[model samples]
Target: MNRPTSLVSALSLALASNAHAATAADAGAGIHELQRVQVTATRSERAIADVPNTVDVIERERMDELLVRDLKDLFRYEPGIAVGSSFGRFGLGDIRVRGLGGNRVRIQTDGIPVSDAFSIGSFSNANRNFVDLDTLKRVEVVRGATSSLYGSDALGGTVSFITKDPADYLQEGKDAYFGFKLGYEGSWDGLFGGATAAFGGERWSGLVAIGHRQGQEIENQGEVGGVGSARTKPNPQDRDGRSVLSKLVFAASESRRFRLTVEGNEDNADTDLLTSQGLQALTGAFNDSVVAEDRQTRARVAFTHEMDAVDAGFADSLDWQVYRQDSETTQYTREIRSGLAPPTLRDMREREFNFDQRMYGVQANFRKGFVTGGVQHELAYGLDLARTETRQKRDGLRTFLVTGVSTPVMLPDVFPVRDFPISETTTAALYVQDEMSFVDGKLRLVPAIRVDHYKLEPDVDNIFAEDNPGVAVSDISETSVSPKLGAVWHFADDWSLFGGYSRGFRSPPYSDVNIGFTNVQFGYTAIANPELEPETSDGLEAGLRFSGDAVYASVSAYYNRYEDFIESMRFIGFNDDGLMVYQSQNIAEAKIHGVELKAGVDLGALSEKWRGWSLRGAAAWSRGEGKGPEEVEVAPDVFEEQIVTRNLDSVDPLTATLGVVYQRDAWGAELAGRFVQRKDRVSDPSYYRQGGYGVLDLYAHWEFAPGARFNVGLFNLADRKYSEAGDVPVVGGASATLDRYTSPGRNLSASLSVNW
Candidate 1:
């Protein structure tokens, strides 16, 4: 059936279910996820409806019910969120909120920031998907600029992953618990399994969890297969991953608690680059065999202490944590080339890359509540300090198959080059926030401010200086201040209005400020730019929320203005040596505005005739534009620079999702459809454009026996062929093999779990 027909049929089924006659007592009340508690927005526990900022919380129950196995699956139904992917080997990159992506979004696991993404050429990519979903108990997502609370790298949003604790498993009479889960997904022929064990005493508790997964290349809606860039079939790939999480907790007194946590995860992939073959026939060189092995690993150890009864009168509670994290990515590629022409010689080329980061940090916060005159106030203050060392190296070698000879093949430069000098980045921040309540808690005000300082120190080594002779790497030190104001007014029963203004900023990265690359053969060179300014954003938002017995809904609108946007490796002009010079600069100003809506209706609560029926939906629409310096050619080989305003292609088009859910005693099912509008607004007219499309998904859950449960999901029920706009390059024009980017067609996923 077509997409529209499928959706109509699903809606018809829902309407029919709603018309059924039943008693009111037989109906069940479902939990509203939008009202859940979250901590990312203010660094303190607060319900989503009470906070002035936009926050979304996904609990473990939601993950299990939806059969979520990866980042893409986790956000399958979210309207304004997306996951980025390229080709078939790079897999999933960072998560995108609204329009901005990549390094603009901040991601953390248990308060430790994830590794940054860095890419050079087409062979090396280090993404930010280091956490395993199985080990997480909940995930909190905060939208819009939030630097006042998170310091830096929170320009677009923040995602925090909270892991499971031992107390979650121990029951009233049980001191130990064990659980197991197994799952399979058809999209990649993936198989995964996990186990959890926990034990607790009166004063101490411990928990350990482990998970493993193996999968093949992700499937797409393509048929053609062979070699070269024209091939529509995905490349052959094999991937394996494992994760381990352990925690130990101790309770010293009634108001004091301590926790020690250790977590690690690693993923490895081997891919055969079938799409890279038969591209180079001019130089009598053809890629006969190309293979790449990519590996990513992350590990962290942390200790935390919390005290509620502080002796100091200024503070009522105190929390502190110290941690050390290490993350690394390594990629190795080996290629063989053969010639059918004159020389009939063969050669082997190999490339190796290693990117590593080690971080040590300490964080502390205090909370106090007091009354000043006739006003009530709750104050929160915190300090953060961290030092990170980053290093990267790229090396390669070539060997002649005919003779016993080996040499490096990097033309116009030497092998074993360092893109940037080894550097230590130190960051320190202090922040304070106060929540004031007036008129018997009907009106609330929140004011917050933060001060941050960062310094980048380059430690040049012989390997870096030897590659780029006479190049001087400069150091950078900068400080920024961010402030925010928010208000919430409860005008009527079960209804409230909220608004906020926030500021955000990101310091220039060490690699971008001191990057070095010289390619004499290509008549181009990329140099460092220590004079670049930091990127900053100012955002204003307002929303209305309603919560009632039979219905709940929320509508929000936001506008964000950004300045001094950093553009990396931007081509300026020809230098004195007739080489095109590329440097990083602050070259753009942009504005993004959007509206979001979420609504749900419980038919069971309204009347007995519609028992066990519920309806839920969400929608998002956004538009963005950027003003940047563009070169206009007035004469042959001559050009003039002009400031131009154009639509930003990073912004996703309008999207809406609707679902019908039904619940009974021991079984339930849900049907959902996601509708996306066509994308046409772009800076370049020739950029690739996609038409509107809709996809239907179905999920069912069953608890047949005590401590045993099962879940099944059928996605893309209509077998629709579509692609996420973010996954496809916008400036590449039209591609002949557009089907290569299409999402999976008709897939199934199922999981089974047991506990005792």
Candidate 2:
């Protein structure tokens, strides 16, 4: 476990992308009919199959049909992506793309970066993938290595979510489109409900969306511990979440338009779980018991304007948008336990952490047609700028037991969460891009360049955080650059080819800059190097697409070389007090590669008399490996030590799906099979290994009643028992780079809806 030429070693162990899932009815016109596909993958509308990249776009109807509760549900259909790979009933996960997850992935909503802009080694700093999936109209996934026009965490590619837009479906002269739904479950005693209402006129429109979800403790299902598998005691936990999305758009003229949108969401929950080394996961249950409480709120306001033929005549339909984003959250931590485990008479401890961030930015674009070589050609250009400010605070009372890992405990009754006041982070970015087409539109090319500048002033958190005492680490400010280039060739109406390459990076995160540790190995003294470099990746992607009136298929391949991958490495250091500390620093590298293929056929032509019956299936498979000598995939920095496995677990492999979508005038139904290839790469204690798995789902909807409709669905129809990964990166500096989190059996849900 002591050698790694790069920051990480990873490949083929089932690497998937951060898939945002939302199901809807067939893209058809009628409630149960197939609708036309109008996607915006290139910042322009077109069919998903027509887009050159290996992209998956899921619509609102499909989203509804799937009854997607959160983003991680992708494992149900989309094979390669597993948000909470090891998500047990709790559903926590690390979004992975290519071979990297957590912060290495980039996410955006309405083209604005929502990831904690705080530098955390060139990826999301939360390391905790944070997008809540409820408020989405559609999710567009750009798979593989990307020199994507976007900069930042996009090194491993990007996932952009488009919130519901009210204009798309509203009738030309209709004033309103309203809908509502409710659902419940038995496992966690869960209940969910939502409502949407929109009103629009000749030149203006508005919409309001509201929703709520609540659930009690989930059944542990014996994955944590077991004899044969029985109901685990209910942990004292409950959760409630809600959101409101509102927007207004104005059509100024035939060639001008403007829009404004505001969104707000909040989640509050109380959780109960046990910590391996003697920490309670929740607060309250008893005087000496621990529990956890979390609360968060996010708000944003955005404005957009579109105008054709600016005064200078240098453009056509100019587009621009400006926005603000703010968020605040707090966590209360503690843990409680019962009979199965021995009590350490642990003293109660309470910890609270708060975070706030503010960001503002704007972008402008132009497109025009020009005469070239006696032929007409198109020209496009765009630019964007943004600035952000972030603030964080930690306040808590933690109890530490000087006793054994088991039984007896409670030496210290209470301690504050952090001995520091607060810290601040700020960032800014700007970029420009352009696209040109030749041969009368048979060939197209795009090139883009972006520059990002970062600065940070991290305030320490330890009571003795500085030279005065036991401080483990701190944050520093640094700047980095990202650039990209790409091209697309339209060889025929039914086929096209594409290639893109770029250099990308995500700044270091809060935990990477602040978390402190003890213990070291001389030259390996891991300390937060405020001077640490940004995690960087150079990536390339190529793909082909074939589509005709009724059939579609796509093949894509990607590769990336990652540097300063920012993983935990041992650092040796001695405080003025002579207490040696081992901290986390930017020191790692990884080579990520993969190939994906997706295809489907329409059975309408062959099924004939069946009228509404058509069948199709899509699949993806990818494999990778760690690069260079010494540089192996290092586990999270939590574990102090671990035995090196025979080899690193590659989460990437073959994944496929088969299903049928039936389209009848009054009813629609679907049946599908989900599969994961048998895991051949094995690592860890003799008892742990991965095997293949398959699950079935059935869904149907009836809309004979005009604005009224109903639907029924069965997930894991056979009640299959299987284990999915909930990859937990250890925190205490243990070399145990990966821990498998498991899942429970299966369940079902149904819903009815009304629209006007």
Candidate 3:
């Protein structure tokens, strides 16, 4: 592929940076990974080696150097993490931490939680991919339950994105800064560009950043083409997105500051559903086809105040923020179905599905340092208050192509129906933690607790009433308390032992608690579950870490137990109306255990002859199972209850990543490999079983001038064809369809960035 003229011009103009020399020296792959500092673990700055938890921080430099284009690329080398997406319609969907994904993992930008991921039937899906990577300064990921500190939707882990600030670009004497980057990705056939500008005076500073991208469908390794289920190629698609981020800062004094931020982004995609052709056999229609267009938009405004070195009676430092975010997802789908037997091709149906949410929140936290007797203590406390309104609507029309007449009825479904009533959720929480050090600061013990209250109010409207009459929506109020204890001991020089115990919980979601729908033609009905209980988990983890000049390594193990797992839309036998009834229920108890290992060696530190060479690797393995009650029929019309235990299919098999890197004065390169074991353990044996595979990747960066640099990556260097277990859909007996989900083959990605 030829480079665009604009990209060529930008690259030529960017040829002036000597920054790569220092980047290679300061960002050594092995040393940097070992000594990284992060803020997500405890909402305070702490070195990863000192924090009593598993945390991974990806800096902007690393993101650029690796050519990370999406969440899948961001976590490609991280063990036990994966990104799942739709088959052909909605591109990226959600991030899976350990064995849990979707709402189980909490994601936030700055201090605000991201929008939720929701799915209904087969036509609509809304995900939580709202943040643009170009505007981010750093990303922090903490694995394991963090609800004691974060709140709901954190049973598995948490991911926090910190955006860039003016201070990051402006130097001590420089009052203005400007930079831009342009890039291309082959797998997606994408073109992207972004620019950042910052200007400031002694007391005030402002920054603005904008990014845009246009791309075609992501490529895959599938060989077959054409229409219907036999087509293994990706559907034809075109996608584009734009984002803007602006910030203003004011410094009242050296110890006090205020900041205002406004950010917004919009993404759109249109796909021709060749894969959906002839899939309407159940509807007695021949030669069926579908086309879909989707749009996602988010806007947020936030204000924050911070005071440091405030020797007040109540605290030493304080931070607070107030923000509002509005997000929406809209999908429009059109289907053309031919009449049975004669094949008239006259039936046309259109559907517009939407999910919208608005949130307002205030969060405040403070830190105080004090001494009691011989023990020095650092105390942290915070409070969170938020209210959100969520709504969903499904509207459609049916038309006769011959007469060009449209009708509102499309069989079992009517136009403009809500799966669940519009609902508002309000939440309030308070949390506090105290860090105490003993043995002359060699030992640390931290204890924390959080109290949270949540209320759900539903407003049933005419659309809901007309769609599902006689159904009553219920309100809910609930409270939960989560506690945690952690300890870190510096047992010996360059060695530490750390362990922690934490509790996590998630309140029942509005859609599950008050969901109501009926399919008269299919003889089925899904009702609400007003008595649903919250899901909770208790996790315990321990690890031993060694950090030295020549080598760094860590080995950790964890075990978690979960209760009241909600299973949505589960069949509960026939109702009095002789229709199959389904409802959400809390019916399972689960247990998961895992172990992780990470190690790196800096050869230069071992000997002078081995300078500029390093080796790093990480591996993870986990197993999970759930136990639930099942009804068995011993005689006619008589059923008895029995306990059944099944493996959790979501958990990926053992995986590992390894990298070898070498750095020179102005250039560096890394060769990496990712390996996964075969997935054989699953809850359903009929589900497709994927075999093990390994892939190799190469990445390099070079600085040709004082202010310009280029980074390139060759992924899947061997052109191997393999599918991640999480990306494979359940094809059941149809094994041929599995090819459609295979990952892309060899691809090239490169970017050129400049600074002034």
Candidate 4:
């Protein structure tokens, strides 16, 4: 990683050269100011260049050109971000930013938070990849801590998805409109289509959209065919999904408006695992079959009033909203095995697991503008309240057949009935921020703060603790305060320098605090810890930005420190049944630092022949370390960690993306490449080292008519075979046979849409 001084110097020199050259060549072409990128995730609408933090916005046009089908595909070219799936698990994956992931990042849509983190057995629901991409109008990604505004789970960053409203579909000077789209993906042998209808009258407007897709299993490059020759290839499965979105808006007057939105999504898949070597080994059976289903539904209502129209003295506008979200995941599996003995005992096992989460919340915001001491100011204050409920259940049955005679048998549960009891959590928060400008708008400062309070109550009677009747489970409560300060100096007409300090914190989830389970056969038990504290962090960032007629660039560097980091810990003492005990505890302190660079150039300003040509690129590098105890097994079933060691779970390899685009008349095309550096820093036992590789992508779109268009995308153009550094390798095999999860090979997709 480059130091701050070197980075600044390099960017300054490039800006000088690019500005002069562009100005000299396009002297008669007139000045072309860069387009202002607007963002709303900051609690208020502001241009990205004016904000004191790193933010990226993906507009509707860019989204359509990329032919994105899912959240994973949407972030393929984004810097400082990586998306990948867990090994051997379908429909399970997460997004990592600045070397941090899981529950550390907050995901929201239209200012409403989604489902809570839920994990049980082989099924996990931490990732928020359930939303439909077609229903989104734009996406905003804020890098670094946003806890000062979003509360907990904003330690790493925030990703907000803005859904489309009826106004988005209603064309200018039009009262009614409709659109239809058809798409196909070659790799998955998939076909999908969608239709949208919207209409608006004098005071009422409504829009409805429906989309459906069905496909076979995803395709991979398969095994390397050397040491792991016996390992079976990826399993084949049948998959299908559907999503619906509808919104209604009422405009009583120019000063007030009301809106209501409803959305639903469902996905199902069935896997034939008879040829999966990893599954066979994990189940200790010859053949296995699995079926999975996931669903999400949400409804939201919002109202906005202009205080100026109402003659309010202290506020400019007021916005309030309430929402309800529900999510559920269910999995069923069956395993069969035959024993080589005299009676030839055939054992069959069947298991079913279900997990569900529901959330309801209401929030209101007030915006006001004022002036003091010859300085201009904008203030925003808000209050948030929400509650969440989580539930999980598991059941298993085993039967044996001897000499062609069926016999019932008693067997230990494959998955414990419950680790944590069903729980309900309530949260309330108050937040405020002020933007102040001085020195005739040349210098600006922003100060913000937020206070959050939460309570957790667990159902002790429903807990699944074995041989531990006296297990204690109590209610937990905590409060956190986060503060942030930022400043930006517009030193030059087209350039600026910005920096900020922000604080973040995350309270332990219900599963982590009230975690309790006992596995008699495995001789292991996990106990609840009510004394756990929240993980807190403080971060500082500095950056420079330049916007010219033909050039735009941004460079930033940040450092973050964390305390009371929560992680699972194992105790040396044994229970009455001689089972090892583990609990979640505050056990570590850590630090992370990273740098990001992004630049773009307009080729049309340099020459006439390349009038529609453009070049753009982004790069990021990050590293992190922590101090914690290293548990060492002194004797059988005994552990000790007298000496502290360095933790390396926060390090991520360098990543970069470069692209070229051309647009002329009604035709457009883009070619881009992504590169990942080799990762050899194996400081963590759970992470696997991976080699570096690069892949290219091609996209093109054409408007054959005024309201008709066609688009095509060819991803992984080189058919390069590789895996991300953070992907875990498949287990249940010898070390030599274990290999990093393989990514999808070359794939092609195309779509056509018509509007009227």
Candidate 5:
């Protein structure tokens, strides 16, 4: 188990650590005394100092005390982890650890898989996460694959959201409270509303909370055609948008609790990258619009019960979840792609799909006081089974008022601009895990295996249209098994070492193998290729952790061998026009390796002038390479030289964070600095490497009264000009419609919270 470091490493540390011990520890406690910290990523509530692996946690108070609004802000003190995409609004942030992102990483809410069977395709929206930030108590980020508590994507790593439970505010152990959030400024202008209430008696407890935010206009960093970077905003249409979220919970009995939640969010956004004639033309991300509207609704039921079972198990817990999403989208726009004809009105497309999923799991665990050859042994074993099914009511219509030289096709009901075929899919998996602790709980070993069976059935004739729209369809099925092994050794009371090896996979997308293009009247379509392989990876991870009340530090590194990657290629035919047709292909292998280190030391008071002073922070660096077609087609030619996620990400490979906060019983203020080098490295051949940048954020908080508090913060204080991620797309022909979505320039917001 990874535990916090002791007061000091050696006898010499006792004196050096004692100086700051009073500041890091509570005022009334011993210098090394530590507050209780509990973590549950292992499917059990245990001490953080006892878990031996690379992990990072951000509690609700810390995130709020710093006035943090974005997920990227947490990455400062954290290393080897990154949040993909900035638009989740707490409902959709993707995670990447050790440079393995997207489907490779698993996102969960209470141990349930977040993705569905249709989680595929470029720009695919996976994990319809409902755990909005307003309702979160904390998040546990397990780096690497030390423990596959869940299945599949866990091979890369696991990021799970643990919701806030009811808190007792009553002097008799019962409490109730409510609050609302509304904000307006240049950067993120929105109206947020929230309420929370909880009840706790000697033997019963309950909690409920809800939050929603509607926003408009995102801050601008720099516009391609703008005269200066000072005010880089686009036309009124570019920055207009809005979103919302809500949550609720109920509980009865000490070990049995249930939560019923009906929450959803909708966004009407401008696909601004599509341009008529602008600098974006140089990047090739055709600037064109057609507004996009996406919405999702989720209903979940979860119950946790602990029992001293007949099987001699000390504790057993069961969990079940039912998730649903009704997705509808429509696009309206016109574009003369070839410029050979008048701006012809693009075909109108619309898509609506319904997804309902259910997952039930039970774990029977035991921690018995047993003697193994005079040495104690504690073992936990459990079996897991989950099944998912999806049925959709789909309808799409696309017709050419007049066929142009080059015709463009879209997926079923693709909105006003394109049309595509519709299909249904179902998937299931089963798994088992065993963890044994011996030598008096000083050492632990866990082994897990999961088997999954996936199948997709689609009707070709109906999907392609009775008019013979050129589209191919097929039925397909596949199965796979993944194994994971891990061990943790508690070297001492305050230090531990751990390592693990695991395998994971990304099943081939049904659309790529089962769906094909159609020419309709042309009688030509890219034939469906049902023979496909899933993208897989085998990973190994190791790390050490040390903890104490005043000083806590950890370092971890991991390596992964990724094989059978799925990629799209130009294997299909091209029309007489310059346009080309592309099909999916199985591609080359890849590898990623990296090291991460983070430590915090409480810098105590230096003099009377520096009383109440404290300092803490961390730093990290990482890199990787592609070994297949990616290397040959992109990056440098050599396999070792090809930059992988370890390098191709938005920011630089080297990054770090530092912050200082001074707090008393009632007030606190802090200043934090972050540095992210520009990606001097690039996969594209066009632009020279980009320049790196650094930013400073400041936060302050004041207790207005016993139950009320006010917080104010300034972000991008230097008003730095930076891009969100690389605007350039590698691995293909150059095009001018590239997207240049940049970060906000400078903005300020004040949030006030009251607890009662």
Candidate 6:
């Protein structure tokens, strides 16, 4: 692909410093600049401009300014990122980056991985959107491959949520402080409130927070069009959620610190399926209902020590952490059928599905800075060990008339029908990275490598094996090595050219390795594949960055090649029971490429009147393709040839965001517009293309008192009826439809926060 001359020229002329590196003067003057430091990029606190990669940070102030309602709102204006939900579902979505989503991207809070990926029949993995926005201090996103640093499941990138600490809320000389926040959303008739308390002594400090939110169903643009048009409205939902966070810090000595943290979150909702309204809706089912409950908890203990006091020649700092995390999701459903002639209760059924996962891990990191032969060098090394266990079960009971009496009976157990066996995975990794600077710090280079070994073991119960006589389940193990290299040339005082090559990989999750299903209604059976190979990718990126006191701009292009891409394949041949077989296999080689551009300016640099004004904008475009086998008929009877198609359904459309802000002493306001191009490149018959659209938003804040503030937001100012480019329809399923899920219409929200 050729580079666009206009884009290249614009980027060259408008470069500035890192997005997180603002000077004290710029801060006091309310001049927005890219001036914050981040640690996720290299596991060390450093200015974003100093790192040779594309990184985005949403600071606490920005979060408050945007009045974000959920995790999706946090990335509404970020380039190369999108959030998507399953068809006909609410409050259930996943984050996608560069066309990859699900388990391919890793999500963590405070450096601890959250939940394991799991999907059962008619139920998908619980979305990771339960974190309280009010408790977050900042969010860091790293684009492109990060497996070299984070190990498996980072084939795309990584997102880390950093929570607020006691120090963040403590006053200069105060021994304790308390804070509270209240918010309301008009779109869903939602109410939210939270309280936090922090205290600090001579040697120890602690912070605790509790938050809760309740809401009715989210409103959307009226009914969808097509066969299932009647199901246009989302299922009726009533949700209640709560979150808790607590942390304790002890300064044992001038050079050492210890911290303990605990966090918990829960979301419960009741949904009315209303299944009788769709084209293939249940004919006789009535009063259908579903209840979903999801919970997550984590506890961690960590220690950090500065080695300078001990005269450790090779080490400047050392850190170690141990943590345990657990998550569970349970869904229950009930339905009544009355299709008989007498209209009597013909059938009553109750079903439940439960999934639980637990993880334990420990990690250690050491950093050393030194000079070798006139060149400055910084070296970092780390080791990680983790173990995960997962279990899933499904059960149902049906009542029918027997000898003129209604009696409830248990359903027969079958392989892949009611339950899945327990599965366990253990992983160990070692990694090292070195940062070197030469030519009086004008040229910098970073080289890193990681080695990982993982084992997957499944303990299938006798019931499943007995039901499916020929099925075989066994243990699988694999090892992978990833390497990365990056460099930056400071060609000018405020300009730099940067590039890097990185490798990433994703091991098969438990669901893919041991998944088995026998769908009698669909006349197909899916069996587990113990020989699945891990997916791997090699990515190359290059870009130029300009960082000036008043202007910041960057443009980067990246290409990624992937191998052993795992995809589900269907075979025509039937098993002994006359059922078609579908299995996941390494079926394709793929490639993805894209371009990202961002620019921000403090207008005050141009005129004194614009001292408190700034403008910011970002745009991204990406495309992907893969070669895989397709069951196409050439002569109306035979099928052959491998075809090329869009590699992943999550490929983002051309998206852009532009905004203007004015901030002064105690008052601030912002206006922003978001746009997405139409997506028609789909080649798969199982998916639908999304149309393009744009929306505008407005926000304002006022600090009425020393420790109090009020904020208001007006979303979808134009009240446009549209769907996100990533909101494609799920084809050929119960929830299948030709219409896309429309976003919420015009909505209003207000919040008040106070501290003392």
Question: Alpha-carbon error at 110 in model 2, in Å?
Answer: 1.2
For candidate 3, the per-residue lDDT at 165 reads 93
Question: What is candidate 5's CA lDDT for residue 533?
Answer: 79
Better of 3 and 5 by TM-score: 3
Superior candidate under TM-score, 3 versus 4: 3
Please, what are the lDDT tens digits per residue for candidate 2 over residues 1-756? 444322232322112121222223432222211122433335555444434455666767666666667765543566556564332223454556655665466677888776452222211122233445657877776664443356556666567778977785488778889888787654556788889898888888888889888987554334333211121333456888888888888888767878898988887767554322232245222332445676767888999898875656577657889999877766656543332223553433444556576778887766666675645545555666666655554444434343423322222212233322244555555555555666766676666666666666666545424322344455566666666677778798778888777777877665556554323322222345565678787878888877665565667787777666555434455656465655545544556566766655555644566555555565666654443224244575533333232333435446777777777667778887777776554333332455567878787778868877776767677776554533432112232222223343466666677778
Listed in order, each prediction's TM-score against the native is: 0.95, 0.81, 0.95, 0.89, 0.76, 0.90
Candidate 6 whole-model C-alpha lDDT, 0 to 1: 0.72
- The TM-score of predicted model 6 comes to 0.90
Q: What's the CA error at residue 523 for candidate 4, in Å?
A: 3.2
> What local distance difference test score does each model get?
0.83, 0.57, 0.84, 0.70, 0.50, 0.72
lDDT of 6 by residue, 1-756 (tens): 121122111111110111322222242233334346889889888777778888888778777777776866788888688777655444656677777776778888887776754554454455556567777888888888899899898888988889989989886799899989999988778999999999999889999999999997777775653323366666666877888888888877777777888888877777666533233344433333334443433334443333324347767887878888777777666655554556555556666666777888888888888999989988889999999888777656666533244333433333134334588999999999999999998899999999999999888776455444455665779999999999988899989998999999988777666665655666776677878999899999999988787787889999988787676433536888888886667766668899998888778887888787788788999887666556555566665554544445457778888877777678777788888898766535434567789899998888899989898999999999888755544342244443436788999999999999
**Cα misplacement distance, residue 398 of candidate 3 (Å):** 0.3
Top lDDT model: 3
Per-residue C-alpha lDDT of model 1 across residues 445-548, encoded as one tens digit per residue = 98999999999999889888887666688899999999999888878878989989999998998877888877777888777888978889999999998878
Q: What shift in Å separates residue 290 of candidate 2 from its native position after superposition?
A: 3.5
Candidate 5 structure, TM-score to reference: 0.76
- Taking the tens digit of each residue's C-alpha lDDT, what string does model 5 give over 1-756? 111111101100100000111222222221221222434435555555445455566667665665544455444446456654433111224555765665556766655556542332323333434345656666677766532345555656777766766543335434555554444344657555566666655555555565555565454554444321222344233322223333333444554454544433333443332223322344332323323333444444544444433343443444444444343322222322222234353333333333334444343333334455745544444444554443323333444335533332343223221122344555566655555677777887767776666666765445355423554556768787877787788888777887788777766655456444444344344545577777677888787866664566666677777776655332445655433455665654556676666655544433445455555555556665443332223334433223233233322366666666676666767676666665555433343444466777787777778878777878789988765332322312343322234567777867788766
Q: What is the model-wide C-alpha lDDT for candidate 4?
A: 0.70
Name every residue pair that clashes in candidate 1. none
